[model samples]
Target: MIGFVVEAECMFYQDKPIHFECTACGKCCTGNAETHYIALTPTEAAKLRKHLEVSEAWFRRRYVEHLTRDSWGIRMHNGQCAFLDKHGRCGIYALRPTQCRTYPFWPELMDDEAHWQAEKKYCEGINRGQVVDIKVIERKLKQQAAAEEHA
Candidate 1:
């Protein structure tokens, strides 16, 4: 027998061609704050205020939760997102935070097939629709990371 060394591409490459398409299930928005907390920057909060046509004080008082003396996140109501409408849809889908926009494509969920499938319990869109391109996933990840950096 002969010995040889070989390298494989990233482990995730093996799980390629993953499929996802948001069906607006809203399960992700309805969870304990720890698992579903959506952090927000001051600027993101301001945008949301403008979108809802609410005053700064009302927006902060109604929709913001202070995680720390200086940090804040979207307020959770009855263990669900404040913006999740009664119909299980995002009320501000057009103005949702980066965290909300890049959903199941998060780095944690895309870790491997197991994570992806595990999350399927909450989000029916996983592996159920169009095949998500790896590059698009990468881009979304980067965009989310950047936004979270300010959160």
Candidate 2:
């Protein structure tokens, strides 16, 4: 009896330099309904509230979904963020959350090449722009981890 072993080329690795630039497609704002929810830190919520000139109660009612006693997320409108405008732009772009600012670089997506490839299907910006600096990726990853820890 003969057995065969197959070797497949690995297309992505953590050390491999990658390129990503937001196309402003707004795909990242929409996610699986059941598991997709943006975690907001207190500072983020406050920043958004201030930007919109809305009170906490008013903001919560119009744009927030309470996830837990200590946590909440931006409300989803038809599978997309309520703040996502008709032009596929963030309505509150200047004040978007840490999650949005550090997108595509999320831990789950960067943990493996397969995860990154799966995300590429949703994000046209992946592999379309300048090669992302390894330092930037590390910094962004650390920032995300800190945000999670604080939240």
Candidate 3:
């Protein structure tokens, strides 16, 4: 019997894919030493409301902060997401914001190697899993962003 070593190819915005399973590292929630925005959709908002057993308006009031007149994202407390629990898990994982669900797969954001590298610096799990199909990623990104727009 012989053992073989396989090297993964580096691919971004192409067939070279990456997958990630959350290690509960909480680095992604901490916003990379700066404030980053995580936008939500109405569907996500409703789901979070159900999870938290609160009204949608109340959930938004407590956990979300509008960044500008036309943009919004989650609010952070002491560098971590306001909704991040002490155990380093999302309190509303089932209904987490679209932004949270789309880690390492933001189409608009990861247009080039530099952008991908920037994301990798913050998310330790970025290149750790099985290769993800690029088309699947693009579809998810489109669905999430469109859903947000409609919401």
Candidate 4:
């Protein structure tokens, strides 16, 4: 027998033809008993403020809750995102944070096959939908990582 070594193209995403698409089921937005705060960044806050035509002070008071010195997360109401409407639609869908924009393809999730598969239980868009290229996934992950770095 001959021995050969091969390297994986991407250490994070092992599955081929990476696929994902948001089904807009809103499960991600619904916080559980364990707390599902959406970590918000200054940039995200500003965007949301402008979208809602609210002052920084007003927005922070109404939508954001300080989590720590280095970061802030969304305030949940009845164990669900405050921005999530009664119909389970994001009130600020267009202005959702980077973390919400990148769900199942998260770095930690992508780093492990089991992690990725486990997400399918809640996120219907995980294993189905359009075949996302690895490059796009990497870009989203990189952007998310950068945003989280500030969080």
Best by lDDT: 2
Q: After superposing candidate 3, which stretches have Cα over 4 Å from the reference?
A: 1-11, 32-34, 55-57, 147-151
Worst 10 residues of 1 by lDDT: 1-10
lDDT of each: 0.78, 0.79, 0.65, 0.76
Model 2 — TM-score against the truth?
0.87
Q: Candidate 4 residues 68-98, lDDT tens each?
A: 7778888777878889987899999888888
**What TM-score would every model get versus the actual structure?**
0.86, 0.87, 0.73, 0.85
Report the lDDT tens digits of candidate 3 across residue range 1-151: 0110011123345544556555778788886325576776545666666877887678778877776665556778887888789987787677777777777666544455677666767877776777667666666666555555554
Better of 1 and 3 by TM-score: 1
State model 1's lDDT: 0.78
Report how far residue 134 has shifted in candidate 3, in Å: 2.6
Misplaced by over 4 Å in model 2 are 1-14
lDDT tens per residue, model 2, 1-94? 0110011122243468888988898988998757888777778889989989989899989998988889888988788898999987899988
Ranking by TM-score: 2, 1, 4, 3
lDDT of 1 by residue, 52-149 (tens): 89999999999999988877789999988999988878898888888888887666666666877888888888878888787888767667666766
Global local distance difference test of model 4 = 0.76
Which residue pairs collide, candidate 3? Answer: none
- Residue 78 in candidate 1 has what lDDT? 90
In candidate 3, what residue range of length 10 has the lowest lDDT sum? 1-10
